[model samples]
Every structure is written in structure tokens, then in C-alpha cells.
Target: MTINTTHNCTEPQSNWIFVGVYSMVFMVGLILNLTALVVFFCYTKLWSHTTVYMINLAIADLLLVLTLPLRIYYHLGMHGLSQVLCEGVGLVLLVNMYGSIFLLTCMCFDRCVAVCFPMSCRVREGRKKAPLVCLGVWGLTIGASLPIYISKRSKASKEIQVDRCFGSFPVYATQTTAVASTLTVGFGIPLVVMLVCSWALIHAITRSAVAQTDLINSGKIQRMIATSLVIFLACFLPYHGTLALLYVHREAVPCSLLSVYHYSLMVACLNAILDPLAYYFTTETFRRKVDMDAMTRMFPLNSQNSEGNNSRAPVNT
Candidate 1:
């Protein structure tokens, strides 16, 4: 089970399974994300802070999914990509991966503000500044990923012939620095902030209905945010954790930690599939669309006008 370090990676028994699973996940993610993009463009009026942020999230998922075909081909056929090509593709995917995480964290924070103190939250609706924020996320992602290009290890090690990819750090210092920075700045801090804010939102939402006008709506949104954060944690924690361990125990690189590392990488790819689900779950408009679809299914002949009147009628009376 000696893991090669160059581009001529030996096909592990698990590589077959990895390719099959990741292929399905990426395809589904691609479709869902594209749908989200269409929704964003076609229904701009329905866009709120959540939906606005979600549009960027969908972009991230789409970009990440786009890179999966290369990976699938490489794994399935043991194709050797040039070092420059591997590094370029890997950097782009890496940016989206972290960009999505950070952006979600930002959205969670924004939602927390809106939920806990709507009067003071002060987020401008329609978010004309959204493009700026997105630009910043991309800039930061590229800035953070610059080290990969500089280090040259992002390309496969010439001696071992196993394409190292992004997480397979060749140098101990570089691996440690990357893992520590990402874990602390990218994941750890964001997770902590989201946990605190989400708990506060829950507390605020559960208070007396009369005391909180938006309690019900806020509760739904908070649950969605919390769930997304939980998925992010579950997916990326193992990948970063094992990578951290790999840094400390470099001797375990290709052989000792290979399986764990590879599995972690697979889980990371699976995030693309789960991320769109998280976005839809966190979005009010998406839920409303789903409810409308369900209603249409339940009453195929009901007119929109009739449904509106029925919705407005007092249920308690």
C-alpha cells in the first residue's frame, strides 16, 4: 500500500469506489447549483439577504463541481495530469471550497443579527453591495491559495509519481502551516461564531410570540443556518484533522495515513452535493416554492387567486 507521490498514481481498490461515489455527488450538485443560478437570475424580486448570499454559494458549489470531472477521470483511468495543470485546477477548487465555507459563515452571522435584533441589524435589502462582498471572498480565496502555487508541491512529487493534490502536503512546514491556518481561521473560528449566533437566534425565536413578531420565520431560518453549519463541520473537520495529523507525523504520509486521508478527501467532495441542499434549506423563497409545488400537487386544479384567498382566511376562527 505504498502511496506514490507523483502523477502516476496507482489505482487503489478504494479509488474505484471513490470515483463512482464522487461522480454521482458531483453530477447532482451540478444540476442543483445550476437550477439555483437560474432561480437567482430569473426571480430577482424574490431575493432577500438569504437568497442573495445563496446565489454566491451556488456559484461556489458549481465551480467546485466543475472540477470533479478531472478528478474522476484521473482516478478512474490513472491519467497523469501535468504539474501546472493539477496545481491550477486544484487551486480553483480549493478556493471555492473555502470560499463557500466563509461565505456561509458570513450569512449565518448576518442572519443572527437580523433574528436577534431586527431593528438594529441594518442590513440593506437587495444588498447592492453583494457583488463587492463576493469579489472580496474570491480575492481572499486566491490569496490564501497562492502558497500552493509557490510551493510547487501542489503538483505531484517527481520521485513518488503520486499526484499529491491540494491536501496531500509534501513539506512538513507547508502542510502544518496550511492546516493550522485553515483550521483556525477558516473553520474553527467560523464554527464558533456560528454556534454562538445560532444559539442566540434559537433563544430569541423561542421567546413569547407577542414579544417577537418574526419568531416563527426567524426560527425556520435559524434552523436552516444551524444545519448548514453542522454539515460543514461534519464534512471538513475530518479532512483537516487528519491532514493536521499528517503534518505532525510526516513519516505516515503515503502509506500510514493514506486511507484516512483519501476518505477525508472523498467526504470533502461530497460537500458539493450537500451544500446546495443546505442552501435551499436555508432559503425562504425555496421553501415557499416547495410549498407551492406541494400545494399544486395536492390541488392540481386550484387557481392562484383561490389559494391566496384561502391562505388569508383566519384559521383560528
Candidate 2:
């Protein structure tokens, strides 16, 4: 295989900065996703529709995190790596990125259904959809990413000789189509669906009788919606936003612009960390420990003569 040199790349040292970013994402994401999976499996009460999607999401995050070391190597210079490993890295990135997106979207949808269609939520048949959706997501994302094989092979900058895998592909008609279709399916569709579900969740919560009296429950619903939206907006939007910009540049994008895209991409990986934290907030067993009653029961000395009424948060499971 011939080595392709890109004179367009000048900032080789900048890769070190990105290495730090990827390293941080890997460490935090690994810890958070592992802890979430452990808690989900250990606690029987956590077996629910939402938990099903969450388990898949944690799996996706863990896999995504595991791949970061390869990305770190990509940034740190692989010294002419194998084309297969380079392509495999890109494939794993695509599958897990969109897999997590779909899983998180599923989670938001589950919450919406629980709030708006509680009867369906209680149904045994309805509960089975979660795992089925998880399976479909894994299949679909992997299938969607098969196109990566058609993309060009890895190339390194002549200045750095740092092999860049899945760095910036030259914009061509096929690549353009790929970017358009991926953005629409991977990010655009899920984003719209999540926003709609989140709105519906908020709307349903406000209209319900529980809204008038069950302040804690209502608050939980709000928190879930807020956190989900924040994760999508903060963690995903910037990367895809930069992707769209790259798409617009057409044919050839500036090396400097490619560097910016890489940075935004790393920032987007923080979702692996953020999503697990959301799990702690939204999961019933995890969230309930914060209630005054749970606190009083666990630490009696701290709650002596507490002023307000002891309104134990309702158990969801």
C-alpha cells in the first residue's frame, strides 16, 4: 500500500491536546458506564422498560469508551497503521455513536409512554419492546456503518506522519450522500423524535392530576426530560453541527477546519459519561435514596426533629 501525504496538515502538535481530551473521555466514560451496568444488574428493582434501554446504552457507551484508546493512538501517531485496524476503528465509532443515540432516544420514548400511557407501560407485552428495540438498534447501526468499508483508506500528514484514520474524507458525491443520509438517520431523526417525546412528556405531566399534588413525581419527570434534552443538545449537537459544516465545504475542507471537527467530535464523546450520570438521576432505586424519608431512615441522628412533613417519595417499580 502506498502512503498518502497531506501537506494541508500543519498543526501536528495539536494532536497532543486531542490525546488529552480523548484520554479524559475514555477514563470517565469507562468508570461511569461500568458503575451503571453494575448497579442495573445488581438491583432487581431496576428491571424496567427504561432500564432495558439504559442497559443497552451503557453497553454502547462502554464499547465506545473501549475504542477511545485506538483513537488516542490515531491522534498520537500509529506510524503507518494497518488499513484494516484503521477502518475497524471508524466502523466501531459509527456503530456505537448512533447506537447510543438510538438507545437514548428509546429511553426518552419509554419515559414518555410511562407518563402518557401508564396502562401500556404496565402491560407485559409492551415491556418486551425494549429488548427488541435494543436488538434492532445494534443490528441497524452496524448495518448502517457497513458503508465505511467503501470510504478511502487511512492517510497521514507528511508533516506529522501521524496516521489519521477516518480523519476528513474528501467530499465527493458518494461521501456527500453518506453524510446527508447519516445525519438524517443517525442524528436528525432521533433528535426530532426525542424532542417530540420530551414535549409530550412535559405536556402530559402538566395535565395529569399528579401534577397538582405529587410534586416529587412531577419533579422527577421534569428532571428526566431536562437531562435527556441537555445530553442531546450539549453532547451531540456541536459535533453534528460541525459535520454539517464539513459537508457544506464540499470537495476539499481546510486542514484547520478538520482539526476543529476532531475537537468537536471528542467533545461529543462526553455523552458516554453524561448518559450514565443521567441514569443515577432517573433510575428509581438510585434517585429514591435522596428522599428525606430514606435519609432519615439511613441516618437518624441527622434528621432529629426535622421540620417539614415526611413525604416519602413514591416507589415507581
Candidate 3:
């Protein structure tokens, strides 16, 4: 698969829209994710299985946000950067993207099992294995993303007076295989798992009298599920949809479609910005650490405690 360099391509005025969106996402995502990390490490107890997955998810979002400035620089006409640097940034982005996906999937599974089998010894045992699961997720994501670096072969173009990263691939097989694997492993399987877990969790909560009695906790879990579904649909769905389409029409894709692909990628980056909301809604510790008084003042009705309750409760999910 030969990679086409956009170095000589003229930038349309609309390209700046991407730059602007990235800038906003970088700033907001950076602040929110870092604050979540600080709260998780310094304030919240970190021993829970869900907390382990949440910590890893926050770290993944943080790593991805850290790469935005370079991307912004690239978007702002700073071309001719080292191919190795470009590939490294691409690799980090890919790893973090899938890392977030898999971690969220784990979280859904954890919550489902907890809700469905609260007293099961297996749930307790799973807590001991949480760290290993996280380690495995990191390893899997890194291993999968390594192909981005290995398959990308950069070369200096004397005519353009710069080193072009991902200039071209020697074989289409690598590109085709990578895209297929990513669609299945990175998005498809995870999507299915999340949907199943969410359904099971909701069903368990509805059928169990204990879950109905704890309205506040149940509400938080439902919010978390809704947020996860929205993020996947808004961010990953369109982007991967475009990827599949591009793969199908690789030989005759229009420039407008290419532009749509770029926009879809930008939309996907919004996931970093939205993940912090997941932390807030799902993690009671995070909610306690944050200033709920101010949040309540900002959004009074939505933030109100149930039944005019004055006592603030932590999320127990």
C-alpha cells in the first residue's frame, strides 16, 4: 500500500476548521483528563477493579492529547517534519484510540458482572486480575499499532527538499490487512461486547430489587452506559464507516470523500474531550473530588439530588 503524501496539496480555507477544532479539543481534553488523573491518584482510592480500568483510560486519553500540538503544527503548514516523528505520532494516536476502546469495554463488562452477580466470589476474584487485564490491554494495543511504524517507510524527496513520512508502501497487502484487522479487532468486536454488556447490565438492574432500591447508583450506571454508547456512535462509528468506504472504493475515491474522511477523524478526536464526562458520571470518587456545588449551580436541575435530598452521594458503580 503506497501512502500518498499531502505535502504538495493546497490547503482549502475549510482546513483551518480542523485546526481550530483540534486546538479546542486539545485544551479542554488536556485539562479534564489531567484533572481526572490527579483526582484518581491523589484523592480517590485506586484499589477497585473499575478504578484500575478508569485510570488506564484516563492515561490513554492523556497520551493522545499530548500529541495534539504536533498535529496542530502539522495542520498549520509546518511540513517536512521527520518521517520517524510523524510515524511515532501516528502510532501513539492509534494505540491510545484502541486503548480507550478496549478499556471502556472492560469497564462495561466489569459493571455488568458486578450488577448481575453482586455476591459471586468470581467478582471478587476478578479484582485481583484487573491489573493483569490492564497490562494485557496495553500490550495488545501496542503490538497491534506496531505495524504503523514498521509498514511506514519514509524517504527523502530531493525534488520537494524534505523527508516524506508514509510516502508509499511497497505492497497493498499490508494496508488491506491492517485496515481489516483494525475494523474487526479495534472497533467491531469491542462494539459488540459493549452492546451486550450494556444490555445485560440494564436488564440485571431492572430485574433486581436491590438495584431499583438504589435509585442514585442505578441512575449513574445508566448515564455511564448512555455516554459510552453516544461516544462510540458519534466518534468511532462515522470514522470507521468512512474507513470501510474508502477501502471499498480505494481505486476511485473522490477528493470530497477524502475530505469527509479527514473530518471524520477530527470528529473521532472528540472522544478525548468526552471521556472526562464518563469519569464524572460513573465514578463517585471523581464526583466527590470535583466541586459539585459549582456544577449544581451551573446545571441545577440535572445535578440535583434525588427527592430533594441534601446529602451528596458518591457513585457506587
Whose TM-score is greatest here?
Answer: 3
Give every collision pair in model 2.
none
User: lDDT per model, in order?
Assistant: 0.67, 0.71, 0.71
Pairs with steric clashes in candidate 3: 1-171, 1-172, 2-169, 3-168, 284-315
Question: Cα deviation of 41 in candidate 3 (Å)?
Answer: 1.1
What is the per-residue lDDT of model 2 for residues 124-209, given as tens digits with 9 covering 90 to 100?
Answer: 46767888889999999886666444443322222233434546343221366668877898889999999999899899988888
Off by over 4 Å in 3: 1-14, 152-174, 211-220, 292-316
TM-score per candidate, chains pooled: 0.77, 0.79, 0.81
Model 3 lDDT-worst window of ten: 165-174
lDDT of model 3 at position 153: 42
By summed lDDT, the worst window of 10 consecutive residues in model 1 runs over 308-317
Q: Per-residue lDDT of 15-125 in model 1, one digit per residue for the tens?
A: 677788779978899888886675566434445656667778888989998988877877675545664576677777778888988887777777667766666524545
Clash pairs, candidate 1, are 5-160, 5-162, 6-160, 6-161, 6-162, 6-163, 7-161
Candidate 2 has what TM-score? 0.79
**How well is each residue in 1-317 modelled by candidate 3, as lDDT tens digits?**
22244343232533477689989989999988887776666555435777788789889988988888877877776666786686677678768988999998888888778877879997879866988999999999998767554644433322344443323111221268768877899899999998998889778766777776855476766776877887877889988888787676665554565667768777888999898886544455467555544345546695655335344433354
Query: Could you say which candidate leads in lDDT?
Result: 3
Instruction: Name model 1 segments beyond 4 Å from true.
Output: 1-14, 121-129, 151-174, 208-226, 251-254, 281-284, 287-317
